[model samples]
Target: MLHIRVITPASRTDEVLRIAADSPAVVNVLKLPGAAFDPEGDLVEFDVAREGANAVLADLKALGLKDTGGISVEQLDLSISTAAEAAEHAAPGDPEDAVVWEELSARTAAEARMTWSYFAFLALAVQIAAIGALLDQPILIVGAMVLGPDFGPVAAMCFGVLQRNVRLIGAAARTLAAGFAVAIAITLACAAVSRLIGWIEPTMLDDRPLTSFIIHPDRWSFVVAVLAGVAGILSMTARKSSALVGVFISVTTVPAAGNIAVAIALAHWNEVGASLVQLGVNLAGMIVAGIATLFIQRLMWSRLGRHDIAPHSPEVAAGQPTSGRVSG
Candidate 1:
């Protein structure tokens, strides 16, 4: 279930109330007229089934509340109302399978930003992976995978292609390129320091048994990446974020990049070549798999009449703001 709060202008309060009253998915409707101070309007609240939230939000947007006032939505952690249960039972489709495109796009787009913290996390993950590679520790490699922040830009690019948003694609590309570059450079420096301190022995790279996974690229690596990509995107759309941890460790993205940095520092040209291939294969597989999964999800939802997202305009495709678009 989801809780919705809408501040409606005086002229449209009745329309908003009517919309809420008519919707079978809405329950516990409350109206407080002349209560809002910010655009100075009525405050309307309701509980709606998660399966039907996108429809209600679309209706609210059609009424222009997003422009005249504002609409806020949050998941209801606890709803004790029998009416809410009836609403959920009455609403068609499973809430777990629902994909709110506007929310997902906005979220992934935000995650694609090239902030200082983003770089720090990526670089730190790579450095950690370097240590894992040198020590041939699977646990540390998995830890680096979990700490890596590279998935955001890849997901953003997939979202951009689905929405045909050129600016999102551009921003994600630049952030990804810069992120990998910075992470690799930082990992290289860390590898040099480790060598200077005699922390990384030459035999670590030569007789790497447990760590060979990071530098080896093959069909299995691509297959795992594809599976992880699908699982990752599904976890995001379904709001089952705990599943992302599995996705994080299922592929060797960060570890491969880290191996590349360490191998270059140690002058292991063959290992460097293999690690580069591994990195490229994993990244390509994830991006392609993500795009395919999201496309299929949108198609399936639209066919079921469960998703009613508006078609993107030219401005929206360019990543410019649209009038009164509501997202949370």
Candidate 2:
């Protein structure tokens, strides 16, 4: 279930009430007239089944409430009302399978921001990966993979393509390119310092099977990248974050970049080239696979009638019948 809060202008209060009345999935409706001081409007709140939330939100958006006032939705973890239960039962489709595009877009937008903290995490993860590669420690490599934040922009790129938002796509691309570039450069500097201290030597990087795995690109690397991409997209769409952690550990993007940094410090140009190939291959595979997975999932949902509750035309929603009380 989801809790919806809307601030409606005095002129549109009737329309808001009518829309709420028409939505069978909404329950526990409340209205407070002239309750918004800043917006100078009435406040309307209700609970709706998760399966029907997207439709309600879309309708609210079409009403221009989000611009004139505000519309906010919060997940309801616990709702014990009989009305809530009835609303959930009346709403069609499985809540778990529902893809709230607005929510997903908002989440990805936040994730795609290239803040200082983002670079810090990415650079720190790469540094850890560099040490792991030098010592042939699989555990530290896996740890770095978990700490990396590359999936945010990657997922945003896929979302931007689906929504045809060029700005979002560009922003996500910039965040990714800049984040990785800085991380790699910083790791390279760290590698130089480590080499000076004798902590990272050419001998540690040569003929070590584990380190070789980080530098070498093969068919299996692409395969794993594709698999990780699928899992990552699914986890995001389904809001299953635990599965996303597994996806992170399954890909070699960070470790390969770390290997490149170390190889450059050690003057292993051949290893550097191979590691670059590995990084490029995994990134390409993941993005392509993520785009494909999201497309298919959206198509499947649309075909299943799960996506049929988009906002009605303005005229249509305006003509919708009202069935509930509107105080004030």
Candidate 3:
């Protein structure tokens, strides 16, 4: 379930109410007249099953409420009402499979921002991974994999492609490119320092049995990357975050970057080239698979025959209807 809070202008309150009334998936509706001080409008709040959120939100957007007032949505962790249960049952699809595009866009947009924290995490993850590669420690490699936050921009890039949002696509692409550059530079610097201190010798990177895969790209690597991309996209849309960690662990992106840093510091030029190839393979595979997954989801949602609401539709949601009630 999702909770929606809308601030609607006085003139459009009825239309807003009508959208709620027409949907069996909306429950526990509340209307507060003149309740919004900043926007100077009425406040309408309701809970809707996830399956109906996209349709309802699209309808609300068509009404131009976003320009005149505001709309906000949040996930409902627990709703004990019988009305909530009925609403969920009335919805056409399962809650777990629902995808609220607006919410997703907002999330990915924020993720695409190249913030200080993003660089910090990426740099630290790469540094840890570089050390792991030098020591041939599979455990540290896995730890760095879990710690990396590269999936955010990757998912954003995939979503941007799906929606054909050129601005979003550019922003996400830049973020990915700049993020890796920063992480690699930092990790390389760290490895160079370790080499100066005589802590790591060039031969330490030669027979890295546990971590050699990080620098080797094969068909299996691409296959695993594609599968990981699909699973990562699914886990996110389904809101199963725990599963996303497994997605992170299954990919070699961070590890490849780590291997590249160590190889450069140790002057193993051939290994550096191979590690670069491995990184490219993983990224290419993920982007291709992620774009396909999102396209499939959009197609499936469209097949349900509930998309944009027509601006000229006659159904004006006048006042409260029997479908919903205002709390006194």
* Model 3 bad stretches (over 4 Å): 308-328
Candidate with better lDDT, 1 vs 3: 3
Model 1 stretches with alpha carbons more than 4 Å out: 310-328
TM-score of each: 0.91, 0.91, 0.93
**How does residue 85 of candidate 2 score in lDDT?**
88
Q: Write the per-residue lDDT of candidate 3 for residues 83-171, one digit (tens) a residue.
A: 99988887766789878777788888998999999999988888889989988999999999999999989999999888777888899
Candidate 2, clashing residue pairs? Answer: none
Error of 2 at 13 (Å): 1.5
Cα deviation of 111 in candidate 1 (Å)?
A: 1.0
> Candidate 2 — worst ten consecutive residues by lDDT sum?
319-328
The C-alpha RMSD in Å for every predicted model, in order, reads: 3.9, 4.3, 4.9
Ranking of predictions according to lDDT: 3, 1, 2
Candidate 1 accuracy as lDDT: 0.83
Instruction: Give the winner by TM-score.
Output: 3
Tens-digit lDDT string for candidate 1 (1-328): 8889999998999988877776788899999999999999999999987766766777677676767999888888899989888887776677788776657867888988899999999899988998888888888999999998888899999988888888898999899889989999989988888888987766788876887987779999999999999998999889987898889888788998899899988888898889989988988999999999999987786566553463353543343322331121
Question: Count of backbone clashes for each model?
Answer: 0, 0, 2
